[model samples]
Target chain A: MNLAQLQQAFRRWLVNASDESAQLLGSNHVGLAVYQNNYRAQLVGCLEQAFPNLRRWLGEQAFLAASITHIDNHPPHAWTLDAYPEGFHATLKDVFPQNPDVHELAWIESALNEAFVAADAQPLALEALAELDWDTAVLQLTPSLRCHDLTTNAEAIWSALWQETCAPEAVMLEQAGGLLVWRRQFTSRLRQVDALELQAVQQVQADGSFAGLCEFLVQRLGEDAGVMQAGEYLAAWLGSELIVGVRDV
Target chain B: MSTSNPHFSGYGLGLRKEHYCDFLETSVPVDFVEVISENFMVAGGQPRHILRQVRERYPVALHGVSMSIGTAEGLDTDYLRRLKSLVDEIEPLFVSDHLSWSRSGGFNAHDLLPVPYTDEALDRVCANIHQAQDVLGRTMLFENPSSYLAFEGACMTEWEFITAMARRTGCELLLDVNNVFVSASNHGFDALAFLDGIPAERVRQVHLAGHSQGRDILIDSHDSPVCTGVWELYARAMQRLGPVATMIERDDEIPPLAELLQELSMARTLGAAL
Candidate 1:
């Protein structure tokens, strides 16, 4: 057989590992299921690693069934299987339209992955602020700090799951929400944020001065809203490593 | 940590994630390290970060498992770009991939699949290797893979296929001794004859690893320690081929670095004694 024919045969044998393929293996089709089982299991495991939140929400049985079917349709295009789940959330959205949170959860998972492997840079030191002209300086995030604006509390659900908090249901208190997925020391951490807080973070990220950000939020939320209470908020953000780098706009 | 010298320390193991903690915690005298090119290509997480740190400490060899050298479609440009980016960052001692093909029609099987032995295949593989070398800006080494089955229309032996590839492209051979043994046992061919077919001067590096046996054939698992028979084959090949840079590749069932170093040290001893 030519190289293409042989590879095509092998591909047929692989997908139909659990089931059977039509004359793909020539004469020796027996015991191929064992190899097929192992291949499918490993691929599924890779997806689980990529989308732990999806896997948790779907559970093992449902996750495996859905994932195996997905792989059958879209076998990995790259040698790196880690990148396969990049668009899985959209796929799940198509499969389960009623559950928008499931699809949103996939976005959170993909965002967290980007945060984990994002480029390493020097996070802003507490002392750097003292050096910066606070009036003119813009507070930029770590550049690796990622936040996906979603329509449900999927981030909170994902965060809870990471903390081993049960209740994998669609009982989101907040309907319109965003997720904060960022690398805090050695690992990725996720949390849910409101639309106002999401905009506040983005303001800082988009080269808006911290004072300007506070003014923008106050304009949106009202004077009574203490969104600019920098003492507690900055302390919390710095402690959580939710910000990185400082530059002048 | 020195980026000035591109040469790796000579003896290193495949940097797998399961052994990352062990590698960081303990400091062995391993000369350099080899990384699976596709593993960290676009992958992030702890593995990618740790890979950067490891690159700081040791020279790395970017070894790939799925270049699909023998594919009928020939080289894939997109995959080559990713590999080139990795080489630019890691600055590895050498960039090598399997002589086997793991992809066809863009369906990446993600396995070190075997290729049929035909003049058509040999020419395609040689052309692909030359193209790879041109893109990578260095000579590449091709590793022989363990086979579970063989193609019925093979025109030449596996060894002849390999040597002819080298002759066709001016590329080097990796000469995976364990794969020779595994494929030989599976197809009932003389492993020594397979080794003899390759040109010795073209051998830039050698790979000595372990294999697992099945009810009917052997699998190049790279999980266990190098078996007695494979080691014997390695020694026999080294005696004739002379010493070459060798690494221990264990993707599954990875043990302690010290344990692998023990096997690596033995290779050093064998390569030097030759």
Candidate 2:
């Protein structure tokens, strides 16, 4: 085989380890076995490292089974191994279809991993907010911020697992909320927010106007409480360093 | 071929996360620290932050694992751009990857897969190297990788291909002694001939790593201390390539900083002897 053809064959051997691809390469079986072993082991190790909390949550055998299934279905296409773990939540969902908690926990780990390495941005200083007109001002969130609708008590489980404490049993929340992950300075932070705050953040993210957020909240809550909640969320987000930029639109 | 990279002689260690506190908080007695370029190639956060702090203390080298220069298709421009941005920032002592392919046909294996030493493979590798060098605006170094399999090839030896590659592209060489020993043992080639064959002047850096013995092959695992056989080869290598920048590369089952420093001192003593 030529260079491209040879590489394609090698890829097949690594991804599938089929007998045909091995024979086509015409290399030693012992050598090919070594390559195959290395390929799978490296990928397994990547998943294990990326989702340590997920591994703990699922227990060892179940996690390994899920990881193997993921590997079989999805051969990595990215240059960095960090990108490999981004799609693992889908695998978790497929494996544990009934367990929303597993999926949320996977999402938490993936979001935290992404946020840890996400682009650096300076949080908008509170002094900068003094000059902005609320009607026309646009607020920019940190690039590292990630959000997802959370239906289970995955946050508690994650925190407990992280602290090496006995984790509480997973249960569906009476009122579903949202999970927000972002980095503050050099540390990645996670917070569980109520549905109203989630909607407000989503509103600002969609339109970035303080007035638009107030309007959206006003329709949800009454005018007085809506505007008050907007102001409170702004203060909390700013204090948490989620607001990174402000611009006059 | 004349290389743009200048020669430096010193001993260092691969800066892994296990010893980040040791390197950042205290003064580690090493000439330079080598970091995996891909690890710090992210957009931001603590990885970059810690690297910045470490860069302030020691001259760092950017050792990458994902370049995949031997891929038949071409180079990855996005990878090159990120690496160039890092190079511009860190001004690393050397930027290097392996003479192996981990990516091809848009599927990345993330392991240092072997490349056949054929004319076609050589041409693709040289072209890829030229592209990478052009994009980075610096001469790159390519290291010899450990291999479990040798292809049914028509053309050249590993060192011969490397010599021609360096001659064609004017790129420098990162002589990995442990890889040489491992591949030699696995493929039943003369390690000394492989060592003597490469152009010494083109070699700018040396890597001394540990390997594990597999069922029938020696695996370049890089998990333990340098074995006696590999150390002896490194001593022989020092005699030929005098005063090259050498470092002890340990990747897994990492020992304490003191243990690594002690291993590095052995390299220092050998260099001093030379």
**Top model number, TM-score:** 2
- Give the per-residue lDDT of model 1 (tens digit) for A1-249: 666776787777786542334255554532353345545766887888888767888788878777867877777777666677886776687678788778887888887777777666565688887767766767667656877677766766777787778845676455576677787666877777777677777777776587787677678867656454544556777777776766666
- All models, DockQ values? 0.37, 0.89
Model 1, position B228: C-alpha lDDT score: 88
Model 2 per-residue lDDT tens digits across residues B1-274: 2248878897899999999999989999999999999999999999999999999999899999999999998988899999999999999999999999988888999999999999999899999999999889899999999998888864999999999999999999999999999999999999999989999999999999999989999999989999999999999999999999999999999999999999999999999997
How does each model score on TM-score? 0.83, 0.99
Segments of candidate 1 deviating more than 4 angstroms:
A5-9, A16-39, A52-58, A94-105, A125-143, A149-170, A202-219, A223-249, B1-10, B43-49, B265-274
Residue B210 lDDT in candidate 2: 98
Pairs clashing within candidate 2 = none
- Candidate 1, after superposition: displacement of residue B251 in Å? 1.7
Determine which window of 10 residues in candidate 2 chain A has minimal summed lDDT: A18-27
**Model 2 chain B worst lDDT run, 10 consecutive residues:** B1-10
**Best candidate according to lDDT:** 2
